[model samples]
Target chain A: MTTAGSPLVGSSGRGRVGRRRARNRERLVSAAAELMAEAGVEGVTVSAITERADLGAGTFYNYFQSRDGIVDAVVAGAVETLGQRLDALTQGMADAAEIYSSSLRHLMRTAVTDPLWGRLVVRLGIAHDQLIATLGPRARRDLLIGVDSGRFQVPDVDIATAITFGALLSAIHAHLGSDQASDPSGVFAESLLRMVGIPAEEATEITQRPLPPLPSLEEARVILGGDAEG
Target chain B: MTTAGSPLVGSSGRGRVGRRRARNRERLVSAAAELMAEAGVEGVTVSAITERADLGAGTFYNYFQSRDGIVDAVVAGAVETLGQRLDALTQGMADAAEIYSSSLRHLMRTAVTDPLWGRLVVRLGIAHDQLIATLGPRARRDLLIGVDSGRFQVPDVDIATAITFGALLSAIHAHLGSDQASDPSGVFAESLLRMVGIPAEEATEITQRPLPPLPSLEEARVILGGDAEG
Candidate 1:
């Protein structure tokens, strides 16, 4: 589906080139994700990415114009389906508090169980453009819902959103740094719910409520209609 | 007094030499502080520091063994007086909530009014060892008081401390990034106070209360018995 002769589209003009281009892009994105998860955004290099993918250095340029292009692709590829999954999980939930709590809980839980996702996020910190682009508006949307429903007493939704984003990154960084055994997703969400004006007891209850299973990546992609070829 | 013939202590062996060494060390620390406050922790280098201090490159090694040494000195020199000043400001306050709010307010207010201090802190973030070493304990100490006095209902002091540290940095980053005219320190502290179980009304009241002046660095030094030369 990419334009002809685009570096990311590869130089091969054969009938199967489109399929090959897509697969190559996927490989490049995953390689960048792994490196980001391991050493952070600043640690990534085009050479390192190509090396990790076991592709020729020149093959990298055939697929990406720069390191930033690959980084964006990695974030978009990872977050698009997950964002859809979160929306699906929170659908039809009337309680805005529960909706917010559920979304945050899922993120925290995934960070714990999914090393690649966790490290990528931790390395990115709170200032990565792609992360904010993908999740910032989603968080604000849920927070606004709570405010509109009178379920939360936030002073300013924008400030609250910033706090929530920072708090999540910090909490995850702390959780991963320590040897603490218990899953902190519940506690982390509880703390933020309270910050947004939910009472302690209610916030605790909402966070501890059984979380539904996250849709698998393949399922999420299908649900999101992300398979361009099929 | 530093041991004789130490690289960190300088090789000069005379009465005036010790005084000169102390003066040069102070100069280097301030130079580093200025650079860090301008360009962040990562931006300062030994060459830049010496250049800013107007000292020879080799002179930097006379007092500091490495760049890390100067960085620590800068943080210590800056934070020590500020920490003591905060202690003086909050002394004899009976209400733990007020004490906590006051401390946080002072920190936030400083960040807004003092551009140098603000930039330095925003650059440091939460994980900088020097920052955590200075502000981390003070925050925890005040938080523990609130918890002990039944004024706060924190689930975990350590986690709360981590959250507060991260939230402050993030909030400041957000605030500075925007052109909002109003000071956010009060609202920021109020939100945290509420998170720790203070009722919204009470948190607002506590945060909005009159803030006392921070003791000057000199006065704080006197209070701390920090006159090493004497």
Candidate 2:
């Protein structure tokens, strides 16, 4: 019952109620993400997400509108979150090569650090329209930036974007398959930089350069605002 | 049907019977390949294969052991055939860069010339075991050859193999998605060559070199022996 005096719906306890709601929503999203990674997009359903989150089925409606709603939440929290961070990280960087390399290195490192997130993106496959829609523009933007600056000798920005998208997912799969590998992110970034026409020596050096950290989720929520409300 | 003089079961018509069986098996495999390309590995079925081939239900058992048997036949006809041809084409090549570029160019061209095959491979995704098993080792071998010959500057071969496997499929998906792009094969192969550490100028020249034609299916059957027997 959403009574006027009930704490959840009551204005008197609004701050605590909002925190609890957000926490439940985050739990639901994380649960859906885990299931999607283990299986694929088809594996996620409302019952599955709610059960995984250990929340009552009735509570699901309080946050998400449907199975697909939670799915988008998961994407926003994973792919979009990272994309926003990459955007923020590269915003002021002058070297387009470094900008591209940093974004990719962070992506490769995700498989090592946040494996569930990594596996989820890899599971979506390249053809998943939402996945393509989210990452494609960011990839194109980065490549085009490099092309505009004459830092990259790309044959076609579209082809290079496709190459980056494909290479990133496959490389993540390979990294997850093998537990022990030496500095995969560096190797991956170096190879991609070279593909975009950076000299081998310079690509190596740029990938070796220290990468700035992604902003914390709190900062991202503030920066990204509506894009990551879930 | 089992009468002593029935042509299909009679000894005197053995040659024609064998030819008919081979043709039927080819038809079944082709049907399965087309379905697999349009849907995915899980999309194939005995009935579906027979239905697509316009053959009677009874005829399916005469050719394949099971649904999986025909799927294997499809892989044998597609991925393995291409792998064998690449092996043949690169047998005496002195430049590892050209060998790599030529093999990639042909793979890219498959998307343009025979799109169904390309779609099937891309649909299989990077995590597909059979696709990886068939293509991964060849990619690793090519990279290692380049590395050992001092012709490439790969940071690590395993990462590069993953990149190639991922890049090839993703690039094919990209090429198939866009119908009017100019010489995607050359663009893809050229970028890959650069990724493996060839300089921009030389990578362009290598990709532009005249690529040898893949051996005919009959010749591939002779050369690859059991690998191409679908």
- How would you encode candidate 2's per-residue C-alpha lDDT over B84-192 as one tens digit per residue? 7778777668989988998899888877787787888888789877789989999899989999999989987888899898888988888788764466999888888
i-RMS values of the candidates, in order?
A: 1.5, 1.0
> Lowest summed-lDDT stretch of 10 residues in model 1 chain B?
B1-10
Model 2 lDDT at residue B111 = 70
Model 1: per-residue Cα lDDT over B115-213, one tens digit each: 566667766666576787778788899999999999889987877887887777777777777785889988888988988899998888888878888
- Identify the candidate with maximal lDDT: 2
lDDT tens string, model 2, A1-230? 01001111212445776868867877777788889999887767888888988999889998878888777767766776577767777877898998899999998887778777678888888766778878889999999999999989998788889889999999998888886445489989999998998888888999998878888555665676667544
RMSD of each: 6.0, 6.6
| DockQ scores of the candidates | 0.49, 0.65
